[model samples]
Structures are given as structure tokens and as C-alpha cells.
Target: MDEFRFIDSIKPSYYRQSSVIKGVGDDGAVIQPNIGHELVISTDTMVDQIHFNLNNMSLEDVGYRVMVANISDLAAMGSSPLYYIVNISAPNSVTNEDLLYVYQGMNDIASQYRMDLIGGDTTSGHDLVISVTVFGNVSPKKKRLRSSAQIGDIVFTTGYLGEAGYGLSLLDSHKHDKLNYFVQRHIRPQPRVDFVRVTTNVNRICLNDVSDGISSELNEIANASNVSIEIDWDKVPIHKDMNHLEHSRLKQLALSAGEDFELVGTCSKGDWKLVRSLCEKDDIKVTEIGKVINRGEEPSVYLNEFGEKLSLDQSGYQHGNS
Candidate 1:
């Protein structure tokens, strides 16, 4: 049989639970616990060519990132991860050592997050692809969504921006140490679990994972909340390393370049100081970057400094753009 036909030949199985069961679906197998909470389930895929270049990334990084990126989605929802399922596809040319390194990397991250690897599928493919479905739990009342923001809620991001794009820039020059931090940020983007945990009590009004740049994510949140967002350029946190780029271009990059893997969230005005202190206690840098305004502003981002509004033409890196 052909490859596509072969994959299609296998049928998915179904399962049923007793009367106490809450929900179950193919996205993930779930069961209600004695405690009342809605378990959030999500999955993500990382392709060799599209998500990471095999030539540029190590085997270990590939494995770790596949899990971390999926975990990021759960973190944005303030979910406590319980377990995960991994599915990997690789070519015959891939060596045993490479495969083992990838597994090791996955295990290392899983152990740190105390996530259990419940099940998975292994398959042979022409190239490489890793997909993971992570299961997490959060109280229904505490669930954070991008659609919940109210006008006047202050916007915040967990860390400085543009490091991932900057790291990709150095790959050509092969300047490893010159941009070690950014490189690491891209290779092993940390899942902001603890930080999300800290903000859970502050009534996290809205939430987004900064996989795409701030502009893209801000636009998404604004559209969801039916509100306009105004970001102060000066208020957007920029790391010292980001200063390597030219002034005008760098600001644009920081605002538009994607894959920063930070958390951008909203909080009521009164909770700012308390949230700031909570993050400080956890050693996480939280910056007040913007605010949600009336929808009349049309969901735009701005650079208002020195009484001038500079134009940033790029809308971040899109997959198919040349």
C-alpha cells in the first residue's frame, strides 16, 4: 500500500468511562478527577524544515523544543500539566545515536516539568517530524483566555523581545558566544510555568503565548477581546543584547520578529503592583508594555517617543514569505 493509504488504513480506537466521566475525545484522552477542574488538552507539531533546520539545530534541541513549545500553550492557559504523548517520524538515514539523544532531551525536559509520558507512536518518514499532545488541568474559573480582556486592563509581557530572531541572525555568522543568550532562547525556549502560576491569583484577564511577535499576538488578543491595544514603544522591554541591531531597524525587529516564547497577559489596574511583586519574588521580569483601549483605535501598535511616530513596515516573519 502507498504511504498515505497505509497511514489511513489504521483506524482510531474509542473508549468510554463510567457515569462520573466529564469528557473524552481524540485530541486527548481525559478523565475527571475527584477534584473539580477542567483539564486543558493541546498538541503541537515541529517539522524539520519548517520548524527547525536539521543542519542548524542539534538532535537534543529538536526533542526538547517539541515538548517545550506544546507546554507553552498550556502555560498560557495557566494549566498544570499532568502527562504527554509523543509521536516521532524520522528517515532511515538517521542514526541510533541521534535518536537516543533526542529521547534523552525529551526525558530531561519532561522530568523537570514532572510531566508523565503516557503514550506515543513511532513511524518512519522521508524527513523528520515530532508531534506531542500534552494534557494539563486548571480550574474552570481560573482559565485565562485572550477574549476576556476589558478596556483599561494593562498589558504585560514576561520577558524582553527579539532574542530569537537575533539568534537566527547569528546562525549565518556562526557567532555562538557573541549571541549565546539569544541562541539559547531560541534553541531551548523555557516554558513559563512558574510565572503563569504566580499570575493566576491576580485575575489574569487575558493571556497569549508570544510564539509570534508582540504585534501579531497583540492583534490576535485585540480582535478576540473586541478592543483596541496601544503599545508604548518605550515601555516594551528590550534586552541589552537586542541593542546590537541598528536603532530604527532594531526597534522594529523587537516589535515584529516572532518566536520570543514569552507570556503577554492582562491584569486590572489595581493588581499591577501585586503582580509585579509576585514576578519579582519568582525572579521573572514582567513589564507593563501596553494597555487595551477603545476599539476606535482599530487594534494598532505604536512607537511614540521624542514626539515622533516612526513607521515599522514589517508585520513579523511569515512562513511562506521570501
Candidate 2:
């Protein structure tokens, strides 16, 4: 099928939104946000082999993942996703059926989040690349920032860590059991969009998505907010599947696995209690792992492992790092 036909194949009424004055088929998309709301925009690109292994991941998984990566950014800022544009470049080796499945995958997530597929472009390339640009809205008072973590604020995360890292390991071993929860996580991560929506409604503060590992994310919050962070090792939530793994290795994965897509942030103790209670009502688990310390500390991130404090290693998925 040709490009036009491909676009037509996936067109659906569900992809349309009132705010989108014009979507797909136009030179550009036109969106109008409601008054008293600020728009949050984020873009992310996923390259084949580098970001995903085509041999291991399905076309649908690729599409879904790209959307999650971009949407997670919006979620980190306490914004609700409104619209998105996807640009895809696929090699000659990819079939039209493959491309359609990709769109289906994207549509599934878009529908779930009530987001409109505004517009995008498709082209041929040496390898598959899916670039997604997402738009969201947040009231000015509810907007969260990575640089707003305050001293003495309690740090929390939405869910357990290290599952995605374990999942990727299983995938690398050519394991194809869909029943394996860990393997499922690596391919289709569940972004903490709902958590952000609920928490921001109650109280908003310093927040970020754990896309590049908790260690890297904590360092980012520390540097951005000019504060030191101390994590209690015992309070960190580890995936149940990781119980069999060596304790040290599990800790390493929990700290450095970059694809978890969980939310990490800080809030006042009172706000933290309120947020935690609200999340609990929705069946979402929030764990308080540490607190923000004063600035000017020798080490920005400290880990209290069995009462032996140590500096955390800032290591995770760094593009181009050998």
C-alpha cells in the first residue's frame, strides 16, 4: 500500500478531538487549548536496534513504546496528554502490514489516554525510526518541575523498580514467554500517567519520569533543585521476580535500569500523605524511599545500604557510551 492509503487505513473518529481544529491530511495540525491551562510539549525518537531490537520486538510493541516514552515526559510534569503527532521512517524490508500494525498499536494507547492523533509524516529510511511529539495541558498551579524539590521533602516513587531491566535480560536470551511478567515489562511499559494526574490534582511538586534509571533521575532532581538526596536502601521497592537474583545485582538493576518509566518526585510530608492515600484508593502503590537533604553536600546522592552510607553510581543507559 502507498503512503496515502496507509494513512487512510488507520483513520478513525476516535482519533479526532474538539481542540484539534484540523488533524491528519493537512499540512499541519491546529490545536487550541482551554483557557487557564498551560501546554506541555515533549518529543522522543526511537531508533531500531539502538532503542529496540526489531528481531525481538513486534511492530506494535515498537509503536506503543515510542508513544509511552513521549507520554511519560508529559506525565512527569503533571500534565494530561491531549494530542500527538507520529513520524515514522521504515526500511524497504518492512511491509505495509507491519506499518499498519504499528499504527494500530499507537491508536490503542492514544485511545486509552484520550489523546488525538493530530498529524505526522511517513517515509522510507535505512532503519525504522518512530518519532513522537506529544502535547498536554496543566493548570499553572498544578505544574510540577524537576527543579522544585525542597529540602526535607519526602521522596517517593509510583511502583516497583528493576522489572524492566530483568525483562530486557529475558528478551536478550531469546525468551518468548508472554506469561513472563518481567519480559512483558521490557516490551510494553506502563507509564505512571494516572498517578501523575491524581497526585497533581491533590498536590504538585518536583517530579520526573524514571526513564533513565532511578539513580540518574535522582541526580537530575538533586542538581536541578540544588539539594542532596538520601535514599534508604531498605525502603526501596524491588520487583518480586527479582527475589531470586543476587542481592547486589538486584540493587544494581533497581538503581540503573533505565526503562522503568515510573514516576519519582518529592512533596511536603502532609502532601505526600494525601497523595499516597489518594493513590491507594486507585490501587496505585506509592513508596517513600528517602528525603531531600540540604544543598552543598559533598555527594549529591547517598544510599543507606544496611546502615552503611555510600555514594550512588550515576550509571544507566547513556546513548553512545561504550
Candidate 3:
């Protein structure tokens, strides 16, 4: 299969958008955004063995994961996904059929979010690699930030944590059949794009998607916003399937297990009430797990379990860290 044939084969009408004046066949994509909307862009790259293993994830899963990872970044900024460009580096071992399956997976989710595929490059490489760059839009007034958290703000997270990590563990141990939910969570993590679209419209929401673990995300918010944070252990929403695990183990996964793709952030208590109320109407579960505090004598992030405080270890998937 040649490169041009491969491109033409996966091209679909759903990837076309009014905003995209020209896409795919052109030398470069041409896009025109609405008058009052600001563009938001994010890019993510995944390597075969480093980010995924064919033994555990199929080609479709790999493509879907790369797309979701990039979209999650847009969601963190309170934006709506608009368009995307995907670049692939495939080895000789990968077939055109396999590549089509990957594109099919990407298109399935892209259709759900109303995102279009623009243009990108494909090349030969020693290992399979997928790189996705996503474009989104947000109203200037409604854009959220990690550096906007305030003292006395309430911290919150969407859905359950630890499920993706537990899923990865199951995959590693080849126990995927034991827990379908956890396994699915690992391979098919959902981004909180809809949640952000609804909640951040009210403003005063400082949020980020938990791609690197909630612990690292909280610390980032604290450092960026120059505030301290205290998370209540009991309030952290661990998946029910993880109930069989020890409390300490559950806590560790909930805090440091990356790739959950759930939103975690803060809002003023008053704004939180409105956000929570609006999210509930959409059937989105938002849990208040912690609070922002003045940076007086406390660490950036700490865990509070039944009034016992412990320092949170901001250790997750850091590449090259042995």
C-alpha cells in the first residue's frame, strides 16, 4: 500500500467541516474559526513499547488512545474539539488493513465529539508511533486555567479514579477477563469534553484533565496558582471494583495512577455550587475531594484521611526515571 492510497482509503466525509476551508489533500490545512471564539490546540505522541504494547492493546486501541489523549488536553482548557491532524510512523510489519482499523477507531470517537480530521504526515519508522494534534475553540471569557485556582476554593474531580490504573495492572497480569470495566477503562478512557463544555461556561473554574495523575495535577495547580491544597482521602472516588484492594493500595492508585483522563480542579465555593448543580443535570458525577488553602505552613499538596495528614508523593509515569 502506498502513502497516497492509504490516505485516500481512510478519508471520510465526516472529517470535513465548514470551518476547515481546505483539508487533507492540500499541502496544508486551512481553517477559519468563528468571530468570537479563540483557538485551542494540543498535541500528543505515543510510541509502541513506551506508551503501549501490542500484546495488551490492539491497533484500534492505540489510535483511540492517542486521539483521546490530545482531546483531554483541550477539555482541560474548557474548549470544544473542532479538528485534528494525525501523523503516523509505521514499520514494515504493520499492514494497511491494520492502519485502516486504527483510523476507524479514531473516526469513531472523532464523530462522537464532532471533530474533523484535517491533514498530517505519515512516514516509515522502526516502531509504531502515533502523534495527534487537536484543535478546539473556547469563548475568551470562559477559558479556564491551572493558574487560576484561589485560596478557599473547593477541589473536585469527575467520575472515579484508579480504574485506569487498575485496568493497566490487570492487563500486565493478563487478568483482563476478571474485570471488564477496569480493562476497558485502561484501553478506552473517556475525555471529559462534554463536562467542561457545560460547567466552564459559568466561569471561575480552574481545571485540568488528570493525564499525569491527580497528585501531579494538584501539585501543578498549587505551584502555578501559588496556593496550598489538601485532599481528603475518604472523599476520593475509588472505583468499586478496587474495594477488594487494601486501603493503602487503593489510595496510592487513586493518587498516582496516570491516564484516568478525568477532570480535576477547583472553583470558588459559590461557583462550585452552580457547577455541581449544572453537572448533576447532565448526569455527570462531580465529587468535592479537597480544598485550596493559603500557602502559609502547609505543603503544596497533602492527603487528609480522618484528620491524619500525610505528604502526597507526586510520583507517576516519568520517562527515563528508573
RMSD of each: 6.5, 3.5, 3.5
Q: For model 1, how many clashes?
A: 0
Error of 1 at 24 (Å): 18
Q: Can you write out model 2's per-residue Cα lDDT over 14-117, one digit (the tens) per residue?
A: 55567878788778877777789999999999999899987788889888888888889998998998998888899998877889888878877877888888
Off by over 4 Å in 3: 14-16, 297-299, 316-322
Better candidate by TM-score, 1 or 2 = 2
Give the Cα lDDT of each candidate: 0.73, 0.84, 0.85
Q: Which lDDT tens digits does candidate 1 get at residues 1-322?
A: 1334322332223222231232222344445553787878899988888988867788888888888888888988888776777777889887555666776677677778776655566678898888989888888888889888888988999888887777777764676753387788888878888887887876655888888788777778877888777667778888886766787678656777777778887878888889899999989999998777777635544445555644222374222210
For model 1, where is the 10-residue window of minimal lDDT?
Answer: 11-20
lDDT of 3 by residue, 189-302 (tens): 899987986776576889888888898999889888988888888899987779999876787688888799999999999888898899999999899999998777544787
Candidate with top lDDT is: 3
In order of appearance, the predictions have TM-scores of 0.84, 0.94, 0.94
Looking at model 2, report the run of 10 residues with the lowest lDDT sum.
313-322
Better of 2 and 3 by lDDT: 3
